[model samples]
Target: MTELNILHHSSYPPESNGHGGSKRTAQVLELLVTNGYDYTSVDFDTIKALKTLKWQKKVSLFLGTLLRFPFKGKNISFKRLKRVDRLKFISKAFIAELSSIPDIYIWESTLDIHQFIAAELKAKGSKIIGIAHNLESLVPCASQFGAIVHHKSPINRFAQELETLSICDEIFVISREEQWLLNLFNIGAKYLPYYPIIETRNNLLEIRKRRALRQKNNEFLILGTVLNPPTLNGTIELIKMVSEVSPANAIIHIVGYGTERLKPHLTGYSQFQLHGGVDRSALEDILAKIDAVVLNQPYTTGSLTRIPEMLIAGIPVICNEAAARSFYNYSGVYLFSNEHELTDFLSNPMDTPLIPKEERVYTDLFIKTLKLAV
Candidate 1:
């Protein structure tokens, strides 16, 4: 039996659950578990290695030179923590956890943790795999020189990200566009589908049965994070803009965490409703109600996870050009370069049409990815 320990970045606490990362992690675990591949994950508290070394070492942690403390990453606050203490903490916690996991898969759960895991995995002669969804790009889009510093850096936070990519036996990105960029850096990679939750619903048949019940119509819609807060600038600014331009009866539902921000400002807005952070079941059920999806995140290269969910649910999607390049929304996604194009598409959205839903499959790509690392 081949045991695979995944060093994943967990957005939500393990028990609290309901986080996208939790969903993703659970899905990967399900695939591996159902297929009989051994798997396990680390809890946030298990990150105590960071707590111990950060305060004690006073020097940066992990990898030969790249995992330095107080890294000047795109997030300025993290830059303040960029001290040797924080780096040491992160390195210790990360390395210790990686020590426990068996055969490893370094998924895009966090940009911060990847390097530490990669460093150890390489040293142990263990199989190491890297998975990248758009989460890797969110932090980069917020600051000045964000892209330049992170992607094309001589001395930057992404040095760790870059190091991890170099160290990992194989790197996997969600989009063809991301894979294209990695190739430029001489990093070999493959493309894979990003998912919302670990497909635990054993009711795949029931899921399709329900979706079939919904009215599959012509005119589509654009909805997203009415529940989750916009961690990336492209998404926040996008919501404000879309609300102003979309049609009177646009059938849009902005679902996720930070609806309160929009609620105070856009009161009584017709055509859309912000359902802040609903239960996962409620969120999943609503997909049938939406005509399409839109993610205007301008910063990153690959597409967001929501885009993938919309596609699997059989909805057409609208997105900025950067987003279009990131995910392979093939039959559904209508791509745009700037606000004007986005507005033009919103005004006249016959550009791209929706497609039928397909029962999603993932393990094959994952197994292949792991093999590359091995």
Candidate 2:
């Protein structure tokens, strides 16, 4: 078979597992590479120096920012102007780097920046495939959970999202809820749920075996990058819940980047161990020792990627309704809406049934969707 030249673009390095978005992009790339596709991955920095902005565009952006200052505040207006300029630069760089029009162009995330690049690629007759990590417009919903979300206009944001997504030939959504919403807007969207890569799956199984050998220590793990506003807010709320319920003999293990921000709140709690960001090996070691994983997200715009990881590892997941949106029916998932319920689950944890490795069919489906799209 003749190799098809494909171009994959992302804002972040797909190889990095620092966050959910990167992990998802890595997974998609893994599928494409293993399926025998000739692909080139490009990020913002890849062609940064190849493109330069004209003085007219710069002046226009400055004037626009100045005009919005009184209405949107100086900081927000300037930030918006800066973001627009960056996107414009990236789009120009992307087009300049293209030696020839690719057979397929896969852009990660339907953010305005990616959309700008997608529009440029589409004009060149390349099949545009967009990966929508989340409905960007719904991100402001985080504010309900005490997360600070800055947006000039929700209605405008929503319209922009629709416009961006509509330009793509096909969209891969991380959750079914998002797919549904996009379809409502007459966009061609497919649900491609997250699944651990083969290596990660095997490692998780090994961790499960190690966990089974040790006696339960009542150690529960909460995973997320604490630097994220929603995660930080959720972690704080979970801590408050744990303090209120005060589950006996429970040791809450918090792991992720920027967890030290939680230290001030953990002064009196000796049971709380904050392992701020660990290497993969260290994280697997921690996973092997924990009895269960906790997800206490008060509000979520996208499905939590950690849910599938814990479920596949046969580790019990204690989460609330909002956190357990997609995997509610999965075995070993315990839901709690109030302090009393959370206390009961923590005090009397149940054994989680191991999910068979073969049950992970999403990976195949994800690859199939891409194949069909092309």
Candidate 3:
């Protein structure tokens, strides 16, 4: 059989599971390799390259900013120049690794930088497939205390996102809502549910057995980087609800990168424990001890991977409607619309049986989508 030449690109290396974005990218890469596709991977060293502004780039950026000030105002001009530099760098990085353009190019994320690279690759006669982890435009604006969070203006972000997606031959979205939104814009999008890297059936059964044994004190888990706006917002709301409703014996464990930043908000809540950025083994150990996971996101954007991860582990997930958007039908997921509802569920949490089915459904769907797109 002749191998299909596929190229995957992302801002972060697919092997890195330090964050949700990387984990999602890794899942796609794994699927490609497992399906026997001959693929090339290119990633922008986000931390070392794209994020860092060297003196030379700074000077170029300043000059470029001044040059475009007459046409686009200083602030917009500066943002545009910086974006161009990042896009140029990404295109150059991918080209340096390319011996020949692959038959298909799959770029990750909805960021303008990735779109720019995708457009460039498409120009070179390669089929372009975009993996939109989240529609950045749909992510709600956030604020801390009284200060507005710094980010691209929503209008500009939405415009850029539309332009980026318009160039794609096909797009893979993480949630049904996102797919619907894209369809409204006449963009051909496919809903690809997240495929979590989970333990074997035997291991999951063991986890279910452990979960079935009711402890004297209920333990709940909330997993996400607190630095993220949506998570931070949801966590604060959860803390308030749990504090008011949870019994003195209950414990809420918060784990993820930047969770330590929640210290100030958690001051008087002794029931909440923050475990900042634990490894896979550590997370598994924690999962074994927890009865349920809580996801109280105020607004929906991308599908949260933790939903599937928890369900696959046989752990119950108590989430708000927004957090449970794409996962409504998944086994072991319970949705709450208000604090009263959340309290009721926590008092007598539902049992989440182990999901023994392999992720072949996701794999088959992904392969089918690729074939149609190609």
Candidate 4:
């Protein structure tokens, strides 16, 4: 295959705080490199460096920020800039970088402003691909950007998001479920698995077997950004359920920021330990001690990046029916309908072997889709 030069644009840089979204961005970059594609990563930070006073660029940005202030706290998207203002922002951000145009331009998250840029690049014969991280309409009511729950008329937001996505030459979604959702809106997309993010350690299966034999009860881990509303609620609920069912042992460990809130809920429970966020490297050490990972959220969109990581690592997952419905192919995942089933699984320890074959499947799909786009 011919090596293609690609322009990658995203608000979240891999090194920027270790959130799931940023990690996904970083992992995709790695996949591109391994496949022999030459790509340039440009973020809004570049536009911030561009001359501000030239041709009222600063004024437009200021006005844009002001207009978006109402939605800023809501976390609707990267920057809440109005459509016109955002176009102005991207134009200034990319003017210097686009001097030597690449064959492909990949946008990580879709925003109203991106349409203008995608159109411009398409006119120049560059393949414009948009990676849909999440469906804007499917954001949970508990989320900061939950427009439907907050009376923002999510139908309008959904329509607007779909309209913006229509401009892309090719669409890439994080999960097969998300791709199905997009298809309903007459938008076709290819699935981009996050399996590339999983770091496989040598002798993982043997290590798991040793850990399983040593530990009398299963130790479950709830990882990711615990402070986020959706995560916070789900984690607390699972801990509460586990506490009621298993009072004699400390089995569930919560790791991430905002875990201090768990103090009020876990009054007499010694089994649940809350370790506020640790460094990325430290997280691997923490995972080494645990037997299974927990992902029991009822409502989720896009893809749960953690699922692939846990599956490939040989750690059993105790998730809800919703998650099981989407990721039914994986063998290590355990699904529960209610609190009883979840607690039952926690009481029984099991071995989860690594499915190394998934890497080739994901890599082949990624390369084939990317090559076709070029």
Q: Could you say which candidate leads in lDDT? A: 2
Cα lDDT, all candidates: 0.54, 0.74, 0.73, 0.68
Give the least accurate 10-residue stretch of model 1, judged by summed lDDT.
141-150
Using alpha carbons, what is the TM-score of model 3? 0.85
Q: Put down candidate 1 lDDT per residue, 1-374, tens digits, no spaces.
A: 45555554434443213445545546555555666666555454567654464533544232323443345554444343343334445555666665464566555543543355446556766566666644344344333222223333424544555654676677667666767777877888776655444343333234434566455332334344433333345556775777776665565566666554566644666666667667767766766555456666544545465565555555567877666664544677778766677666666634223432432444576665655444
lDDT by residue (1-374, candidate 3, tens digit) is: 22667878776665434577776887787677676776777655533544555789768766875776577543444555556655676576656557787778887855754566677778888788888888876677632111112235766556657777888887888889999988997897888777654323345556666666666348888888767788888888888888888766888898988888878888888899889899877887888887788878888588887677677678888988888988787778888887788887778857664573555775687777677655
Per residue, candidate 4 scores C-alpha lDDT tens digits across 1-374 of 25687888876777423666886787778778766777877655556446454657667667766766676556344343444565565664675456676788888867654566676777778888888777756566633242312226667667777877888878888777878878887898777766444343233433454454445346678776665656677777877777777536546777776777777887888877777777655666656677688776757676676676666556777788665545766778888888788768777766664553455665577677778886
In order of appearance, the predictions have TM-scores of 0.67, 0.86, 0.85, 0.82
Top candidate on TM-score is 2
TM accuracy, model 1: 0.67
Better of 2 and 4 by TM-score: 2
Q: What's the residue-level lDDT of 236 in candidate 2?
A: 89
C-alpha root-mean-square deviation, candidate 1: 6.2
Clashes of each: 19, 0, 0, 1
**Worst ten-residue run, lDDT, model 4?**
142-151
Residue ranges of candidate 3 with Cα displaced over 4 Å: 15-17, 43-66, 74-83, 89-97, 142-156, 198-206, 209-216, 354-362, 372-374
